[model samples]
Target: MPQAVRTAIVGTGHRAQLFTEGLAKRDGYDVVALCDPNSVRMAFHNRMLLAAGRRTAHLWPPARYDEMLRVERVELVVVTSVDATHDRYIEAALRAGVRVICEKPITTDAVKAQSILDTVRETGGSLSVAYNYRFNPVHRRVRQLLADGAIGTVHSVHFEWMLDVSHGADYFRRWHRDKSNSGGLMVHKASHHFDLVNWWLGAEPHTVYARGQLAFYGPGPEHGYARDYVRAHGSSAADDDPFALQLADNATMRDLYLDAEGEDGYYRDRNVFAPGVSIEDDMAVLVSYDTGATMTYHLTAYSPAEGYRVMFNGSGGRLELNVEESTFTSITLRPLWSEPVDHTVDHEHEGHGGADPRVLAALLDGEQTEGAEVADARQAALALVTGLAANRSFETGLPVRTADILKL
Candidate 1:
């Protein structure tokens, strides 16, 4: 391992900023450049770096992010780009002999994913997908218990995760609305859930039978063809209605999505009932894994309380987890909790059941993460392959095998 991971970022959005800030506050990785096609997004991050008193010499404007890869001689690349564009930056980094740390759901389709897998094989460059949930503490505990035979031979996993309308609708509002970009909710959002199941069971998905529909969102018979619910625009409108997302209004979101809307007119706060949404708001899947274990998974977007319940049953006893009922990162505070609270960092003790900071530290410090097991590219590919197969299963109304997709 290099003394310092010379790193460059290809996307300067919310996730990119989080990784950059995490890297900046750490010792091993040096983030040399931040790049986005939108100058405003790039400038937002550059200003953030400056405010943090980090050097801005290497901050590459959106247009030059790719060009900076050659000039900066970055040894590693942290890819936080949008789902559709992830393969390009990753491919470039691998081509340039740079290791890549990509955010999850690497690509929206199988052909591109195969291409990337091939590139990684051809280049022998390290490609680590960031499935941070696996790095979370409680999930780790559950994995350990399963491995120790505390849960015995796992036979089935029953998992249900819900994102409330406020948080889930945001997906339909943003670039994720395009199936070509997001691969629907199963591949885009369920990737996290599917990956967790794979890691816990230590098995890849064999076949998937899914059923999903754009249940609540899009031009519904109830709402007619209205494009927006509030008819508001820009960051100032973020707080106008608590139930509605004002990505154009929220300063953080505005800088990332709204202000940069010029490059692409995709609104990040369109009403969930709008006519253009391309993704589903409710989904369910039955997945069979290669290890002879099976899983029944359900996801919905209209719940009042956001949280998840995953019960793992092995030959031994069963392990169950119930995430607190609330959205992971809702923009506005829900009234149930009194007083102002910073759930992101201040809740470290309760952070994903104390999995958040630990994962961050592990990713930054190169130490063994606390809860879950370490994953290689094959495991990462397996997780992704399962999610993609589930998506196909939902579409084709048939069972799609992960092995069939990978042609294994």
Candidate 2:
């Protein structure tokens, strides 16, 4: 490997900021080029680099993405593009023999997942999927306790994740609301939880049965929250709506989306309650793991509070976790005939209890992470099996065997 990884960014969207900003704080990771369809969005990132006192990178349109790799002498590609477009950028980089660090979900569906997988096998290139939740101190502790057999042989898990209106509604308003684009929340959002469960247990998902519905978001008199506007940016209807995201209020948002909208016309603040939502706001899934551990999971988008509760029933006893975002994260461990031991971590940091910084170091700085192994191309695809299975089950109304769609 070179002393500095001459990296090219595939997307200049909001999620791409994590990589751009993180690279700024690290050494031996030089961002040499920015490739995106939106020139304005690319310029926004250059401005960010300039503010950080770093040299600006040359911007290239998507048509010349491959050309940029050769011209820039790129050694790595960081993909933070739309959910569905990840595979294209990832596969291209892999085939070009350039290493890659991709944001979660790897790719939205199995086909894209398989395509990337095939490229990895062909090129033997490096691909790291950033599953940052694994780096959260609380989650790392959970893995340690479980690995120590504090909970014995785990048999079943009940995991429920709730997204508050602010964060959850944003997904509905974005391109993620389209199933074709994001593979719904099953693939878009819940892949994190699924990957966490797989990591915590060191097991693979075998089959999944699921049910989901668009009970909250989307337009309709039946949904109740429908506003008479397509987007929130300049609409009076959104003036009083609490869920409206005012891109103008946030400097980064305004620069990245609102100010750049004239170039691409992509709205950063779409009305969450408007029509065209094809994804579900409520979802439930039951998964069977290769270790014979069963998991019942549920995700609800609109919740009064945000966080998740996970209960693990094992041969010895039960271990439970309750993470309430605004409050605290608690973990209780109980062995048979033993009193429960409780642990709590102060949640002062905004980015997943400081997991973001840790993961950034692991991904950008070549630091060895202590918790769940950061996903490689194959591990990343394995994390997608349960999500893809659940997504299939959502449509078929039947249990989907993971082996049927578990391609790596």
Candidate 3:
């Protein structure tokens, strides 16, 4: 058998654990080193590996990333860092002649995204954006149906994504509450939805107009949230607060975040209704695609349910898909027929509806699962620019052209 690919992962956050643990179970990949600014988080990851009976990876500070890459002989760098920091690691890996598999949104802004694209072009580097939703069995089936012309000549699309309190509230509690960190939910969360549309329709966005607001998770008396503490870990306000996530409550969370809080002073449970939170909780966008297809999309972070409803209107007929992801309910597909078909998709795996494992397999082993396509730099850039254009539109209150935002 061929030697395992030497890999290094930056950012020892919750997401990084998924990749590390998944790689530990596979043979063709070896996680050699882990880099992060906080050493406590790195220690937590090592502890996790030891607990799982896997070899603990060496840890390095963020400043020593280049040294780690060279000394560790890392062939591939897996970036699971914060959204704003993704471009930095991606550029470093490309410049070092190492391949990269980065978590989505590419970067928080247009300049960073363009910088990454430029570095990729300059270094002739290979980068794959992990848009794992494409690997979902139900989503893969949709792609197959679309490819097979189940809905001939797609003309328009309407997508609505709802994030329930458990998942959605977590975003506001962490670094994602700041636009600089996560680019708000538009570029951060909506990247997944936008990429799905782009891949499913085989088109890129041309123009975007958007409206968004921070109606829920911010300082507002009208929101009826009365909280005095900034963080929940040792605060009295969090004792019985439903909105507060006590890191000490769960063993895993305690070890990963609560114990790791000393190194970076990064609190995992910041008040959701705290002041200075700049990201929007509700958004509506209109996009025109290069393929002449128009899309109307809406994202609500605080919702009663966690799922999405997407409908593709075609010249021949319409294909509608509604997924309630939280309860593992059946995914309903209505093909403009009198009786629509309902598919009970049991992924029987964890993380992003079993897409995470498939993504890792494809990246590490070159394994091609159904509907899984390696997302290149250009495709990732287009999807990112689309959301960035929408963000620009939201700020300027005008329709923004994707080409202008890209300026490629």
Candidate 4:
């Protein structure tokens, strides 16, 4: 039997739990230590581990991450930290000669992203950005169809992603409301969609133009929402607000976020319509790919539904995929001039349409099923730069070249 890969998770947030719990069920991967600034969050994760029938991992503060890595002899570091902090941990792990599996977006801005790319180039460290969307069975099938020339030479793509009040409001209520922390939804959320386009088309972005606005979740009476307390918990004003997420309502949320709030002062339930939120809730982007393919994508967080519709226009035919998360419609794929086919997407596992488990298996157990895509630092950097350039376009109202932003 192969030796188990000793791993350390840098963040103990909700996303980190997916990897930790999934790793517990898999062989040849042992989560040895957890690194987070908040001890309470770490404790919650420890309790989660115990519930999963796995041994509790040693906890280390973020300041002692390097020491924890050295002492634990961690072979791989999984970075599920904040968007702005990903580059720091990634670069440090590379400098320490440890492998890394970082979550999507890689980093919030171009400078940090470029730094990570430089570190990867300098150290030749193993780094994989976890774009788990590519691991979804239906999405993998889409990749397979594209690879098989079912769509022929792709010329253009149109993607629209909608996040309903439940999911979309969550972003506004957290650190993601600040562009400094999350680089807006364009960088933080659209990275996944942009990467899917890059991966499916087998190309990189060349130019990007975008427009965005904070129409939904910022301070403005124009949005038609009355003023209220900042957080939902213990607030009478938020008691009747459907958009407010009561962290105390869900045990998992209560334990993970509400209980940990005292240590970090991080409230899980902030008013989505409160002032000081910097991120946009609506955005549209136009991208030109190196393969001569053009893409028009829009992301709206304050939507009535949560799902996406992506259409690929190719030389031979067009392939369209429609997915609605909260409905019974499932995933439907249609090729132009053919009957629309319904694909029963498996939601048996948690996280992003069952992509998390497959991603974890690939990252930890070296299990690469057919059609699974692994994005390296370079690929991740390209995807991130696309979004960053889009954001710049949104600000400057000019088409921004990915190369100019990347300085490549």
Candidate 5:
């Protein structure tokens, strides 16, 4: 039998905790170390793992990827740091002869992305971006349906994702407010959505046209409710706020976001109508895929509920996926309220229709099933570049083709 793979995490952020916690709960894997710039987050992960009855992992001083790999001898590295810094850790892991499972969008810049890919070629280290939505059961069903011609030759798509005021406001309130770090959600947040579209269509993006703006969340009307003033709403020196993290006061908010604030000063509970926020609360785009299918996409910050509605129009028939609620059940740095609804399906798991668990399963245990479609690094890179191109188009008031931007 093959031995369990020893893995370490580079960033102790929210996604990093989710990945680590999932690893701690599952078998056939060993959690070796946790590294974060913040000692608080590192200690939090250590405590969480210890309480889970697992051995504590070695904690690095911070984002010291070189130091951790050199000393801990980790075989697999997971990169969940901020969007712009994904390439740094990924490149480091690959150079150290370690395979990597990194978060999506690779990086904000295309030129730098090509350099990382080039290094992966030289080092021969495998890399997989964690676009877990492709593993989702409902989404998996959608992909299969599209492949089986349940949705014949997908002609066009209309996908709308709206995060209500509460959820949308948090992006601007936190570190994500900076486009440089978070890539303004186009790359950070929409990468999941874009990857889903890529997987469902089983086609590469050909062209894209988009437009968006900071429609709300900055200098907006104070909508009668108290802000989750977690340290004066983005002041550099604000400590973690106990009131905002009060799970008893708001169960959903606590579980989805409050628990994960140890790693960063960013708060998941900012006021939806707070002043001085910078990220865009609204975005819209139109994409043309290589297979002659076009997709219409829209995202809004202020919505009544979270989740997505995807409608696929094909030559033979049409299919639709209505989530009706957010899939995120646990709160970390972001306060999430997963709506409770009994989904009647044969398969069930947690996170994005259980895609999260399945992804880890496949990664650790090797491919379990044949005929499962997997997106390669290049494909994932294309999706990120497509979203980035859309952001450029939105800014410049021009239509941009994905292939044109990618120069493919």
Candidate 6:
């Protein structure tokens, strides 16, 4: 066996747990440090590390990131920080001659994305974005089917994602509700869907047009959801509100956010309908691809249930994927002038339909299975810029070209 890769993860939030737990359970990775603004959150992760039978990692403040890299002899940095902050850490790691495995979107806005693009070209460094949806067995089969021409000469795509109240309301209560921090859901969430379309068609985006609004969340009587309370932790108004998240009930949320609030003043259970939300709850986007294909996509953050529907139209036939989250999933092929066929996909493991482990293996151990290839920084940028174009369109009421956002 080769030497272990000394790794450190930035940000000690919920997402960071995936890397910490995955690294602890796997070989070829020695998680040496946790960098974040809150020492309380870092210490929480340290306890988790001990529970997994791994040695505790050194906790470093965000200000001392570079020093941690040098002192710990870190070779890889897993970035799961705030969306807008991704570029800062990525640039720093690349500059320090360290490899990076970043969570999706790469960065929130246009300028940060361009900076990352420039830095990657300048340093000739290694940066992989974890678009784990691509590793889901069902999605990988779709990629294979598309490549094998099961859907020949793809022309159009339609994708609609629905987030149920329980899952969707959480976003409204968290840091993601801020547009500046997360670039709205279009950047923070829909980038995953955009990347899926880009990868499935093996094409890049051409033009994008979008319209979005905060239809349900935020403090406005018009929304019919806002409670008078700012947060749910100590408010009687939030006790009866269905949209409110009770963080004190869950051990992780309670320990990670409620108990750690004094260190960072970040609340995990804010009122979903209270004021200060800048992100949209409903979004629609239209995109044209470099391969002469077009896609119509919609995302609803206030649905009664969770699931998504994606369809592909091609000269040879049409293919459809309907997933009711963890409940039901179906893939159908309807070839022109032929009988319709159904394809079944079985999930092999837990966590995002078994995508998490596969991605962890690829990122940490450099293990690449057929149909489960990792994404490069350029691909990450393409995904990010596509969302950026949609966001620009949402503001300007005009179609924005992907090429204009960031030069790839």
Query: Each candidate's lDDT (Cα)?
Result: 0.73, 0.87, 0.86, 0.86, 0.70, 0.89
56-87: candidate 4 lDDT, tens digit per residue? 99999988888988999999999998889888
* Residue-level lDDT tens digits of model 3 in 238-355: 7878889989879888887888887788888998888778899999999999999999999998897888888888876777777787565454445655566665467544678888
- Model 3 lDDT at residue 150: 75
lDDT for residue 370 in candidate 4, whole number 0-100:
83
Q: Is candidate 4 or candidate 5 better by TM-score?
A: 4
What lDDT tens digits, residue by residue, belong to model 1 across residues 288-323? 987899999999987777788887776645666666
3 against 6, candidate with superior lDDT: 6
Residue 374, candidate 4: alpha-carbon lDDT: 82
Clashes of 6: 0
Best by lDDT: 6
- Model 1 compared with the native: what TM-score? 0.87
The order by descending TM-score is: 6, 2, 3, 4, 1, 5
Lowest-sum lDDT 10-residue window in model 5: 329-338
Superposed Cα deviation of residue 243, candidate 6 (Å): 0.9
lDDT assessment of candidate 6: 0.89
How much is the lDDT of residue 206 in candidate 4? Answer: 96
TM-score of 4: 0.94
Going through the candidates in the order shown, the clash numbers are 12, 0, 0, 0, 13, 0
Q: Return the clash pairs for model 3, or none.
A: none
Q: Write down the TM-score for model 3.
A: 0.95
User: How close is every model to the real structure, measured as TM-score?
Assistant: 0.87, 0.97, 0.95, 0.94, 0.82, 0.97
* Lowest-sum lDDT 10-residue window in model 6: 218-227
Off by over 4 Å in 6: 221-223, 347-349
Identify the superior model by TM-score, candidate 1 or candidate 5: 1
Superior candidate under TM-score, 1 versus 3: 3
Question: Of the candidates numbered 2 and 5, which has the greater lDDT value?
Answer: 2
TM-score of structure candidate 6: 0.97
lDDT of 6 by residue, 1-408 (tens): 988889999988999999999888877788899999998888988998899898999989888999999999999999999888999999999999999999987999999999998999999999999999989999998888889999799999999999989998888888899989899889988888888888999999999999998888777648566678888889999898888888888998888899889977898788887788988889998899989999999999999999899999999999999988878898999999999888869855477888998888888778886786888999998888878998899889999988899899
